[model samples]
Target: SQITIPILSGDEVNAILILETNQEPRFSLSDWDFARRLAENAGIAISNAQLYAELTRADESKSEFMAFAAHELKNPLTPIKGYAEMMLKGATGELTDQQKQIMHVLRTNAERMQTIINDLRDIARMDARQFRIELSPIDIYNVVIETLRPFMQQLEEKGQTIVNNVPEGLPLIIGDATRLIQVMTNLVSNAYKYSPPGSTITITARPETSYRTPNGNLHKNVMYISVADNGIGMSEEDLQKIFRERYFRSSNRAAQDQPGTGLGMMITQHIIELHNGEIWVESKLGEGSNFQFVIPLAVEEGGDTPETSPDAATEPASD
Candidate 1:
């Protein structure tokens, strides 16, 4: 049956085309022309609707960035700045162990704020196509180590568990080390945030020799890295839209509430793509999630990648 719904949510109206071809052939030609015009009009309406959605999303992203900058970013920075001033002035007598620890937390979080800001600015440049990757031969093993180090102290303090399953003799890939590290950092951070206390988050990487690119081309010696967590996974609907801008926490996350800018994953995509790699996620509602990224093995200088290793049983130890 021909669709009865109006085109583009009634931003334009359309009707079915029926013809009495048994009548004048001239009349049929006129009817067909009108029908063609209606179809063309529908396409225009769809284009306009798509343009509207893009504009709206851009505006919403901008507004969301401002709100986060003012509330989440600025609010934390103020106290951190004030405390540093107090410590420098010696106005607040000798600091106790607890005070020193809290100060350290503040200083660390303030540095994190700077990192988030840098990511945001990088995203803007990326969207403008002005971003470039500094490709090099990278030791992904060391990259994983460096990326996971900053969170070690925090994980210990929170009593949270992390398991790093990346193998010791993994193939190195050619890509931008900084961006890949950023991608891993974002996924690990998100996993840590949504995961319950004492639950474990595992980071794993394996070479994918069987996978093909979207263009149906074969990629040799490609490695796929996954960061998986035993946390509250996303719903099917949420999984479908997880990379969308401005998505916040789920309805069930009261205790796990964190400052979520929602652009983290979006920016992560930009970074990975900039490195000429692909990233995706798999999850179930109650089961855990696995965020994965793929990069070619030849990108690294010293990676004489051998045949794929049969090491599915290895556990992550970087946690």
Candidate 2:
């Protein structure tokens, strides 16, 4: 006698298991049941393994393509920017007020394109495990101030108030200055983008008695930095998906008018994790949102290192 069993992957039958035995009863009912269970589990395991391999290959291909495309796009930006600047400066020729304004817009947009290209390059580096952070002792408060400075004009134009509550004499933490500034800038930008005019964005810093690491270890002497906004708060679902997914947009009315690629928070989270820190958010639907992260006050000497390559590649290429 022969026994046949369907092996399923998802809802489809991926294969079949067959058993033929010559015994007194060939196979008992109990034995057949056991065999079915084993075969079903094996089918699921095999399906998962196959899917993983396929996804891995596709991700590698995507990374290579992104790196190539980002590099190609970056090459032409220099001339575009230079020409726009030259025209604005009258290096090409004198221009009327209207022409000057148009040239200014061209230059500004070119700069924004350059920034997007740079971000793409960073994403490629992250996929390739080439994204590096130079760590050193730095004043976190100063970084926050500098990051907020450029946005002052925009905030003022919108009638928004920025209150910097980061106090002086905060313990210097080991961090990648540029990356930390980028994180702060991203958070502050989100606050500015989502909040209505006349709303206040507050930057606060304090000492955390205990900070938890990603690996479930808690460290002492931690510094906490937060950016809070009284803008349209996100739903619980949005908050849960924000950092974990790419190109996630909020359904809030305040955010609907804002233009963003939605990659900022994703990049921000990776940067904090690179510093061996953790990030989180607190929000209510009708209230507001507070975004925060913590880093060790003092890193152990010689322990400065980037995250593992496999870990860095986990995030998709920045869009």
Candidate 3:
């Protein structure tokens, strides 16, 4: 007696399973049914394996392209920014007020382009597992202030206000100060970009206990930081997908019109993760959004908590 079953993936046959037996009884209905089920499972597994391979290839290709494009785009920006700065400083000659304004615009756009390119490069490095952070004991308060300094002019121009409520005396955290600044900058920039004129963006931080790490370990002390803005908020759907998808821009017209590559949040998430931390958002449509993250505090050699002054004044960054 002989029995054969075809393994199918969708409508196509992927393989055949054959059974041969020399006995008084031939293959029973139950045996044939079991064989068919087994073949079906095999076909599904094979299909899934094929699909995963294709996806891996596509991801590698995308990473390569991103790296190449960022490199090429950044190369030309060096001279563009350099010449703009030189002309603005009268290296070429004295400029009229109009010419200086033109140079300022040129320099600003060039800087924006450079920022986008750097983001792309960071994304590529993250994909390639080459992204790194230099850890050190740092004051979160200083990081917040430094991050806000560059945005002061932008805040003034947009009529936006930044309330820096990051208190002093918070326990020092072991983190990359530069990366943390980058994370803060991205959050504050988004707050400014989305909020209406004269709206207030508030930054706050505090100490927390018993925070859990990704590897199931618990840290007894952690620093919690948040950037809250009364800008256009997100829906439940957008909130769910924001960190999961790259290049995800909101469907809101106001959001769509804003200039962004949709990579800031992604990079911010990665930086937090590198510090063994987590980031999250809370928002309501037409209201505003608050972005938050927590990083574990550093412990001293003798298990004593080394502390700083938590008495930093709560004030606006524009101050």
Candidate 4:
């Protein structure tokens, strides 16, 4: 005699459970009840496994699409930006005021598109575990200053001012100088975008000798930096989700009005983590916001001094 039980997931049968015996009684009432119960549990587990597989496939597909799309979109932007720059520089001919303004708009939008494409590519690389940074001894103050240079004109137009409180003489930190600049630029840009005209954005930094990680690990000689602004701040709920969620945009009207992909903070967080650092934000609804990060200082082989001079290297802005 043989008995067969079907494993049902929702209304569909996913598999069969069978028992065969040559005895007079192939199965008992209790045996049948146990087999059915076991089959039911197995069905649920199989369904969950299938669902997880589907989700993984979908995530992989999305990342692939983002990478491909970003590459394709980036190709045509090169010529567009080049031509705009040539025209602005009078390569073709002397441009009129109206023509200059038009070219400026073209160049600005092209640069913006390039920034978005780079973000998408970075995100895709991060998903594939291919995103990397070149670390070296870097001055946090110099990085802050270089990052703020391009924003000066925009700040002036908006009647906003920036105060650089990141003093010199602090111990140099081990980091990717370019990536650190990117992180600083993102924070300052957000401050400029969300803050009211005439508001002040402050950049501050200091050395912390007793910084402790959440895991109770004490980090000696870490550089702490913060970008603070009296902008339209975020809610407690938003502060909770900002770094955790990718492409997360706040529900505030000011944030909604800003043109952004909501990927900057997530990318900033990833960059900090790559350097064995931590970043966080403090904010209230009507009050300002403070975005801060801390990275360990670079220690020389024989002593605690930095290997490189802070004034030795300077990163120039691109056109």
> Which runs in model 2 stand beyond 4 Å of their true positions?
1-48, 82-95, 211-219, 299-319
For lDDT, candidate 3 versus 4, the one ahead is 3
Least well predicted 10-residue stretch by lDDT in candidate 3: 309-318
Candidate maximizing lDDT: 3
Residue lDDT tens for model 3, 1-319: 8889888878988889999999978889999999988998999998998899999999989999999999999999999999999999899999999999999999999988988998999999999898999998888988998898988888999899888887667788889999999999999989998999999999998888776544355656888889999999998988988888899898788899988889999999999999988888989999999998889787787886755544556533334
- Per-model TM-score on C-alpha atoms: 0.65, 0.73, 0.82, 0.89
Task: List lDDT for all candidates, in order.
Answer: 0.70, 0.81, 0.89, 0.88
> Across residues 1-319, which tens digit of lDDT does each residue of candidate 2 receive?
7888999888888888999977677788888898899888988898999999999899888888878888898888889889988887889788999999898788778777776776676777787888899888777767876788778778988999988897656667878989999999889988888888899999998777677745476867778899999988889888888998877788776676776767778889989989988898888886778998888675445754222112323323211
Each model's RMSD to truth, in Å? Answer: 8.8, 8.3, 4.2, 2.9
| Ranking according to lDDT, highest score first | 3, 4, 2, 1
User: Cα deviation in Å at residue 306, candidate 3?
Assistant: 3.5
Model 3 spans with C-alpha error above 4 angstroms? 1-16, 22-33, 167-169, 210-219, 307-319
> TM-score winner among the candidates?
4
